[model samples]
Target: MDYIQMRQKRFLIAAWAFMECLLFGGLLYGWGSLMYVFKHEGIYAELCNNNDQAALSAMTNSSSSVTDVTLTNSSEETKLSDSNFKGCPEQDSKFTLCFTIASALVCASSAVLGQINFMFGTRVTRLISMIIFVGGSLMLAFVSKEIPWLIFPGLSLLAAGGLPLLVTNTQVSNLFGKGSSSIVGLLCGGFDMSSAVQMVVKIAYESGISRQHSYYFLTALHSLVLVSTFIFLPKDFILNEEAMSTNIEVAGDVNVTTELPIELKERGDVVNEKTGGLKENNYEKKELPTLMSCVRQPLYIMHVFWLCILQLRFYYIIGTLNPYLNRVLNKDDKMVSHFTNICFYIMMGGLMSSFLTGVVYDWQKRCFASSRSSLRQNLMPAVLPLTIVSFLAVLLSALVLVPVQSLLYLIFIILTLFRSFLYSMAAAFLSAMFPSEYFGLLYGIMILCGGVFGFVQFALFTWAETYVEAPRHTDIFLLCLVLVSFLHPLYQWYRCSRAEKELTQ
Candidate 1:
């Protein structure tokens, strides 16, 4: 790609990243604000009360006091009869149900989107995701109390919009080559900045905008994103036969004989001996590894396992951050807002970490290239250090939770910053390790596994809360989980170092 084309690709990556930010903001993080609107406007209460009345009417004794429900304007607090005031539990349950269903759908949609990307291509998958996102936002805006169930499907569509983010990451990796970690980091930074979207929505709500209007605004924004994606993203950027052929040659040549472990040379396994140069005829009959074959690799399995665990912990922490802060600080509204602002700053920290990590990744890659070293030499310098630092940060953050609340908060922020950087770095590393054609499928599988683990952990947490007194310390449990998650990276590092030592001998 020339200068203009490279610039265009970068611009396209930025646009896609922005679109991903919007999808996360409007669908995932925006839920809490939207649910607050439903409660404040008496919509959720009314829905619960209707269900109660229907249940009562079905029984022979229908003597429950009827509670009057009315919609309150944006400026007024919603009021219900005393009999209905206790319906908060039921309303909360209903909201949880919708949220859970939407989350499950998002996971399912991610898997489906991966298949679509593999079978059809990135263009079709992204266009479909964009349309679904807009449609979902419109549904949320127009849904009435008569069909409260519409919220479930609307949220599902919104969640599906997130799938295109993975597609864009793959595209960036493919276009710039696997070593373009800085660019991927820039894109991931845009993703971390999604918290700004939530902040904007919260401000709008505080300014007295109704939920419907907020959703309408999101719909319009997504529509613009859709059009921009269609115009800017190249249709031929996805992996094709030609691209795969070229990449095969590149992958074949990365293993310089000098860098191979001596044991490998003794076994006559080095590539430079027999295949000195990449020729078209050499790969003409070679078949790319299938997705199943990749999955069966021990290293890949370890990667997926640790990635899922990290994602599960991160998702849980993010989902419960507000409640966790409230429990820790016992703050009033103004103070709570201040703490939330601090969280936003932490997000900015994450953004910077991502960008910096990317720059370092590219730098390390350049160093390896200059030294005529193998890509394996770049792994420890470019990726393993970040993983180790992030894991330690998480462990320390959990350990410090028993100290002063303010101190704990600071440590947590540091943890979040590095954790965010680690996520992007891992994604980029995996993208480089795998072939472009199977990247979507593998990435989607990782996401699906993460979602499943998150759901399982959530269910376990709920069970503990419901059935146990003095339940296990969640922080301690998370710390242990983080510790266990580091084992895979340690294993990889050990193998790499051991191989390098043998090669040097």
Candidate 2:
């Protein structure tokens, strides 16, 4: 195969990975739509019905006549009608808890999964994720009111399993050379769009399709991933240009031989005189930077802090989205459903947002591209993307405070862009600043910290439950916290400017 063939193969692999991510990466985050279906399916409706029954019993005891008791019972039953039923606090809390646990797992497992990828290679990591995802989908498909608790584990596994797809896909950017950042952004965008799957599922459910069947359909789609894993993706990791040069077998022609150092040949590395150094497993043997060293870096610390505040804010907003919409829309279920669908639909725009951001980063990188510059200096352009993300986050928080029904459209639009930037830029920046060898580990740490911060969302949801205006106050608090994120960008900008000045001198 020639250059064109190799490039085409790489592009095709990247495109396929993008499709896989868009379809399955982060469906758990689409909680609003999925929760809507869950509520309609009466996953925890018994709790609400029992509360309704208790209310009925109390009313009967307080009534002086059978007619009054009958009227009260009729009204209660009518309100409990599944068509227009608004869930009780207890039921909503259970859903919130499920999201909290699942989302936490999504973030928390990043490092361990990254480690698995680092140690066991892409094939093993993807296989593990595939099995977990299939099992989770099956579990969710069979979930009923009789076993409502299954949602906890099912959702957890689903989220944890899907994340590796995103992690593995981001590395595909390595194939694109200068356009690598853009590729990373596009892939993250696909992950963002995965949230729309739940939106589709909810729409299907409203159109007479069952949640079980919808999941079964999704489970069937997993075959595409299984096929891609074995056929397209590298068994270990994608080799960079230097590594690629060392392995002549990569181009499907083993006639060429590249001599290896004596040290390597003595270490049981197979150096064929006819076929060159076919050391496919040698990529895994390369030493990566220590995890602690990466963690202790000021840049990593600031990035984690930057990601955590935004992640917590985003998670809280998603976890309480239904209640917040209900409160704003005066519990109009129809309007709430309409807006929820619109919100998720807009989330699909994350792909465009990420692509544009990646373009911006790549363009800026071209401007700053210098053969003499240090890696740190070359990465200075990333500060602009980071700053843009911070500004968007602040704007999103401010918009959340307005509570106008009509503004939700604009809010969702901004939300999609902001979220796309959040994850995409985080990955892009880390990959640009750190060694590719450490990218997985560092990226996982960033995600793990952010995921841990996500737990705070439960507390905020509790506040919203306890106080009618708590969401408003929470928005205000988030706005303030997001303002702090500006510090990371500002500091980076200063560093970039300083580095430029030194370079000029």
Candidate 3:
């Protein structure tokens, strides 16, 4: 708790914050945006192989020629939409299953590899992983023929790179002491900001560029992330990186507590009263954090599950942006055009405001958790209101999905940002529930679920797109609203129950 120690903690936290800035630049955003297209297009390409336009055009047609008139036109569009395989029924579920199964397998691979990476320590492994990541992502630029073949090596490299993202926060916690929430807030904020940034950058590149060349731009941006990782991550970021130990040091004039306030201190003494803490262990410990124990804790489980759900929709909405914008706005223009600028701005503004809320939210948790008996207990109740507001916003936004004028369209723009901001609060909720070690694992698993959610979501969107021929934005909005409304209370129930259980324990 001395000044040197505090200084070390700040230095460490700063390293993690730097790492978080990579955000969607490295592991996440592109995959997030591409989830649906990858599955759908991947399947369509695999089935038809080198004949994309023909297969897609035929499948999309209201009617086909004599050779393609295999199925009669007795069913509603909705029925056919739900079932797109009648024309070439065999290729339908194959894509859906493969995408889901592939992602799940990769997710599992990440979970296992993460444990291996930890054994080698974060700094070396994270950098090595990055080296491999760039090599894999760069291969994507040359993939023209045999797209299915690209799926294997391409996805392997992608998945390998993906695992480090989950571990980055833990690395941050290692760099920065958890005394200030700013580090964590910045990490989460960086993610939203980068996502917004990526959208803008991606749009700008689309001016005269082909869609295939879109990813080429991100390679440069990701290269910047790699450079930043090395520069920002301190030499002492590794627990064993430093030969000399750093003691605690306060960075500013402000008073910071290295111990609980006397009134809030645990009332009783324990057997570990004279126990010495481990020198190398900078992160907090879970009493018994086997996956089952973690999962069995309903509050913790709900925190993870709710985060995954909110993230799933968040990913879903973002992934389907190209089509969503097309459905709700002008189809002639590309997504990167000025027409989509407003949506990007709204997302940027909302995310920044949401970032500022973390300080107040965490302070509130400090107030509620005044007792020091369990100093590291979770404060996920703070997230309940965010869930409620977000779910309601989504419902409200859905109700106004079919904006008739530029004004309504503008409202939808802001509403989408509001929805993003509201749901994004769940990340804060999640960080409070799990400490650094668990943070990466939790993030990886949550995102893995999001991958599957993304697929299901794509399937649903495809069904809806096929059904609502003329475009029913209102119906789609209402559908999202109803689902959110149902899920919100269940999350609330789970969170409150968890808070109560933690208090009782």
Candidate 4:
């Protein structure tokens, strides 16, 4: 395709991918809302019913003077009531396991899928995701209390399948030139916002729509992935500027630099107009680093550390959202549901916040563009976004400790901003710091570490379940961890400044 046509197609594909990801990519993360339906459907209610029976028998055996059993002294603990005992710790734990496993699968599967995409091409990988997502939707559609176990595989498959679309779509951002970082942020935003899918389901279920019918609808909607795989997405990958420039040179389009004038200028290179190949101004292309070499760098290690810490903080909040809300809202069902929906609503704004993060990175690039020859200069742009994300994470961890109910709105806002930048910056850092060829593998491994850290949320949840002050204490602990994340950006800034000084000398 010619330049004009190529640009049009590029936009069309990017928009298509964005919508697809928004609808499916991270839907499982919307567990906050989806948990409501699962509870209504009584997925593990038998466990709760059985526990209630056991508790009733114990209370009958004990003295009538015993008003309440001490269930670990937590504010959210299940109570042994004389008249009725409705707390379902057993049921909630089971559901928590389901979400924990599903969310972990979403991240852990990334490395494997990245390898798959790298080896078999994007089409094959997406085809696999299509199968997994459709099967997951089908399983969820047929799930009932009798088949609660279906939720485990159903949610896991859905999370695993949806992630590929987000992973693959990051490459499409290259088509946008300087605004590519913004597009990366937007794609991450779409993935982040996909959590709203379950919120929509919760809203619909409240409107008298059955869970089965909703998932059935989602199944039908997910089938469009097949269409996207065959029609919209390419067999291999999107051509980035370097790859596209190579193609242009081979196609006899001599004015390669003219076609990408901004990029050419960004590298401090100029081309001859008349001769069509006669000039270069202070630009030298270096050999790309090997994947192993890139991974071994201090910067990469710190980036992974930053991701693991912030990710754990975010996942802990997500995993314990129900109990946390239940405790703070005093178990007011209607109010809890209202706030849960509102949290998802707040998450939808991630698209804007994420896109703005990319804009900030790109603006930083422009600000540092004059010193194109320095490696330190190249690294400076990334530091600002990194620092911003760390700061937001610290703020979120601190805010969760406050007992005031109204502060939840502010907490949710900061949580959304923190999450939006976390994933977007992760992708942006990998793409900018590493070669595109290994982007898939490195990106996957980064998330894999973070995913492993996500399991720690279960331990934290258990503690919160057992202790009266554990939730607040957990927040304080996570705040300390979040504080450590500042070291990554600090080191980056220090390294860059030191390198700049050495160059001047």
Question: Which is the leading candidate under TM-score?
Answer: 4
Query: lDDT values of the candidates?
Result: 0.58, 0.79, 0.45, 0.79
lDDT of 2 by residue, 1-505 (tens): 3334546788888889999999989888798998888886768887786576654454345422323222356554523445444677888999999999998887888889899888988889999999989988889888887998989989988998899998887777877777889999999999999999999999998898988999999999987897667777777776444335554445454454442322232233554444454455553333434667667877779999999988887887788888878888977667889999999999999999989889999988877776233433455678789888989888989988888998999999988989899889989988776656667778887888888888888887787778777778878888998899988888877765665566578
Q: In candidate 1, what are the lDDT values of residues 266-309, reduced to their tens digit? A: 23333432333222334422245567867776656777787766
lDDT of the structure predicted as candidate 3: 0.45
lDDT (0-100) at residue 110 of candidate 3?
A: 55
Off by over 4 Å in 4: 1-4, 50-87, 247-288
How high a TM-score does candidate 1 get?
A: 0.76
Compared to the true structure, candidate 4 yields what TM-score? 0.86
Query: Number of clashes in every candidate structure?
Result: 0, 0, 18, 0
- Candidate 4, 1-505: lDDT as tens digits: 3345546798787788889999999888798887777775656666775576565565566444445555555554554542223237777778788888887887888889999988988889998888989898888888886777998999988899898999887888877887888889989999989999999999998898988889989988887777668776678877667545544433443445322221232343455443333255544333344567667778788999999999888888887788778888976566778899989999999999989889999999998877634555567899999999999998888888886799999989998999999999999988776666677889988888888888887887777767688778888888998899999999988877876676578
Clashing pairs in 4: none
Residue 352, model 2: lDDT of 97
Runs off by more than 4 Å, candidate 2:
1-6, 49-79, 242-288, 370-376, 503-505
